[model samples]
Target: MNYRIILALGAFVPAAAIAQDQPAETRDKTSAVISVGVDYEEGSYGTDQDIRSWSVPATVKVQHDRLTFAASVPWRWIEAEGKGTIVTPDGPLGLPLFPSETQVDQRIVREGLGDVTLAAAYALPVKVVNLSVSGTVKLPTADEGLGTGETDYAVGADISKTIGAGITPFAGLTYTMPGSSEGYERKDGVAVNAGVAAQIGKRATGFVAYQDSASTSDGLPDGQRVATGVNVGLGGGVSLGAYGSAGLSAGAPDLATGLRLGFLIP
Candidate 1:
């Protein structure tokens, strides 16, 4: 083996060992939390080109007496080119007097409400287990011709079960209701998502998750999409998280990515 490889491995060993030396009970906690986060992401708004944006998301959560309630609001400011037609490919093509370059220049600045979520969870008096029902409403905040704002809603349930070694596995189900759009009739669909998070070191936790939503619109094909993300706790109820995912099927477009720095308040 190369000497450089040995040196790199030597440097990484201590960090890994320190991460694994955390106590189990130190990571186990049940507390009500309210968090605010900011993210910077560069991706396609509704097309193939890259669009960069800064987002603000604030979440409030409470878990007590075997019940949980939470809400999240996200606001975004986007900057890019060639993202005009939104989820549809017709707006640019439909204009007889409009040129492609003209549409690209005017479509750069786009802003609106991203996704709002509300959730309710109940612990069944069982050890290390809980069940939750959540609903997300996508308001018509983003412009239709320049963004994806047809207004949709989703209802889902989440199950979290704890096993050995401080690992919890979670699964979720969602039903989607389509929005109003010409030539794009509403079609209902389902989504399934699963994830796991584990304690790392004395003050950190890490996680990965995947989710697939059914095709609810004829405008796009029906298929599966997978997304994975990671989070690291920075102690004092503060954490840094980052996630990026690409489409597993044709229905997915413009590999989505995001990073968040969050502060939790008790």
Candidate 2:
């Protein structure tokens, strides 16, 4: 109970980083946004058994001057032959590892809130590339069935350059340090992303990204994924987005898809 309160409070902390790639001149514009989305993913995680999960998330973001603050949390439902919930922004990464065993396998059907993620991004002014630095904290607010119930921290930097033909190329690197857990001997990990975005139509944009993440613990394979998304703007502060992704390696999900709806206050 006490830890739950701490997790809720920690979510509002401005310690996490988010990427803000807007023009430097428009960084000072004050704005607020609310978004909601649902995602579903299925994978074997190098095991014979399959794990399927659904995540419904709500997010709020506010920008003041050049800094943006955001918080997001998800309600997750998982079905698998597993004992661990272990939810993260990247989704669950196989079952937990016990001190005695590298990984545990058991029947699991769980549903609840996973964790709360807090972030803040500070945009750096540059004429050529838009650069931003930020960090992230995942607060464990859910029970063992939904989360690891341990706090996690990460920091990252993003750089992007927009060139001719409304195309932008971007790259980012993030380092994550998982919190201590009883059975799970979590480890520090790094993830890298490279992507290119282009305008597809007057109101639509498309992007393709490749992501790779090091293993975070024993028995979990490294993650390699390819993802794509399309976003379209509707007049009057409304936007819609859709995404699809596939895993290229063992630890990543086999397939995932999601849709997002956003409203902006200017």
Candidate 3:
């Protein structure tokens, strides 16, 4: 999975706030946020070898009135073994042929900066519903093969409604424009996610979400994931959160986990 996508998904949770019915003059507030998190995932992309990755991402967000801006950067480590068969089209019968019995297995490890992402969002409130529209861009910063060397872009929207008991249910849709690399071709795709978040006591919240996406490249499969997590307020405008996700498809990771610390400035 792409580390940049993971970061964007993380951002969606806290950023999808429902606007309360307040006086027009009091609906706007200026705030800033800083968040740091570490994520880990392991999966086999329909291959025999297992791929594992770890990332530490830090993000800064500023919101004023109805506009929000965010930027995120991450340091990532990826490890995998290259033991799969190498198919060649130069066989005698014009058929693809695998490597002979003389090939050796290789281990690969890459650790360095991951992609940097920037996003802007605008919120519109209509009665009891809040709608957000956002756009994001991913900059190529990782090592040659560690990340997609091309820039990526995406546009998305979220709709949320705050019900009674301090519970908010939200749904989002995103369309991604995948970038092209030297030897790979990408396809545009869409993803959908829905979840409900409920306040637990006065300073804590719990949430459960489900996400599904279409294939973003040829030969890649679609994905489904379910996640549950909790955020606990630590006072002083700070909070800590932990979450875990389970993949429900071949294209998704088997399991993923993360922890985050966030600070809000008003």
RMSD of each candidate?
Answer: 10.7, 7.1, 7.6
Question: lDDT tens digits, residues 104-136, model 2?
Answer: 666667787867888777777666677778777
**Candidate 3 deviant stretches above 4 angstroms:** 1-26, 84-104
Q: Residue-wise lDDT of candidate 3 within 22-98, one digit each (tens)?
A: 33574477778788998887776445556777879898878778777888878877776556542211000011112
- Winning candidate number (lDDT): 2
Inter-residue clash pairs, candidate 3: none
**Which candidate achieves the best TM-score against the true structure?**
2
lDDT of each: 0.46, 0.66, 0.64
Residue by residue across 1-266, what tens digits does model 1's lDDT show?
A: 01110110111000001011112353344455555555554433234544556656666665445455666566656655553343422110010011143344455455665545454544344444455454555455443333344656656555666678767676666676646555445577776666676656655455555555555555455444455555666788776666565556654433555555655555
Question: Which 10-residue span in candidate 3 carries the lowest summed lDDT?
Answer: 88-97
Order of quality (TM-score)? 2, 3, 1
Q: How accurate is candidate 2 locally (lDDT)?
A: 0.66
Which of candidates 2 and 3 is the stronger one according to TM-score? Answer: 2
Compare candidates 1 and 3 on TM-score and give the better one.
3
Indicate the residue-level lDDT of 20 in model 3.
23
